[model samples]
Target: MEMGAENKVGTIKPEGEIYTCPTCGYTDGFHVSFSALKNNRKAEVFLICPNCHNRFRLGWHVDLSNT
Candidate 1:
């Protein structure tokens, strides 16, 4: 499907840091960032399984230190 400006960051941000199960297929949005979340400095990618209602978070480090 086509991606909009809000969904162009390559990550899905939900209201609360609640993610579904990755084992199940469920193409829906999930929460990644929360309050005082300093550990995750990079962008987290949430991918829902199409077959089962599963949610997976891909934590990436946006190393701007080199820049």
Candidate 2:
């Protein structure tokens, strides 16, 4: 199987601010940030699931405290 348009975001479990992968439900993964939004307040990251190796393009709400 390869990554294509079919590999998109679906169901996401609302378990606090921690965002999990919608495809494999993995709690942890590698993130690659490409773009920023809202004056660098938020960012778009390529989240790769370690469990299933599924890649997801998701919007990440930048944490102000972390900045």
Candidate 3:
């Protein structure tokens, strides 16, 4: 099958955050970034699974430093 631009692995952001792909059950290789509410205690992230090329939006709490 021919993969389109959405499926092609282009320039990925250099971040170490890992996420699991719900579509293909891949546990590695995902492009993740904070989408909104970054200043708040909770935030949302945009993810693109490299294994299955599926996109996901997830909300999570931020880990604040005690310092």
Candidate 4:
């Protein structure tokens, strides 16, 4: 029985959204992806702070379509 990290399955898709941290100019593309299946069954976007290397997750969804 080998349960490795690579065996993890993600259901989320990256919509190419960039979020800027207020504390710093850390701009990281927030990829829309799935995490924690049971208690947390919601999709989230993550942004890594370049300055402080802090990981930020925006728990909100926004339509980036022109329409």
- Which pairs of residues clash in candidate 2, taking residues 3 or more apart in a chain or in different chains? none
**Higher-scoring candidate on lDDT, 2 or 4:** 2
State the lDDT at 42 in candidate 1: 43
Candidate 4 local distance difference test against the native: 0.42
Residue pairs clashing in model 3 are: none
Q: Which stretches of candidate 2 lie over 4 Å from their true place?
A: 1-16, 33-44, 59-67
lDDT, candidate 2, 1-67, per-residue tens = 3434344533334356645666667776445433454665555445556677666554445554463
Task: Give residue 64's error in model 4 in angstroms.
Answer: 20
Listed per candidate, the RMSD to the true structure in angstroms reads 9.7, 5.9, 9.9, 10.5
Q: Give me candidate 3's TM-score against the actual structure.
A: 0.41
Q: Model 2's lDDT to the true fold?
A: 0.52
Candidate 2 similarity to native, TM-score: 0.37
lDDT of 4 by residue, 8-61 (tens): 322223345456555455566332333333344443344445565444444644
Better of 1 and 2 by lDDT: 2
Question: What's the residue-level lDDT of 28 in candidate 1?
Answer: 58
TM-score of each: 0.27, 0.37, 0.41, 0.33
* lDDT, residue 11, model 2: 33
lDDT value, residue 61 of candidate 1: 35
Candidate topping lDDT: 3
Per-residue C-alpha lDDT of model 3 across residues 1-67, encoded as one tens digit per residue: 2223344433324346655565777887677655335455545455677777666654444544455
For candidate 3, the lDDT comes to 0.54
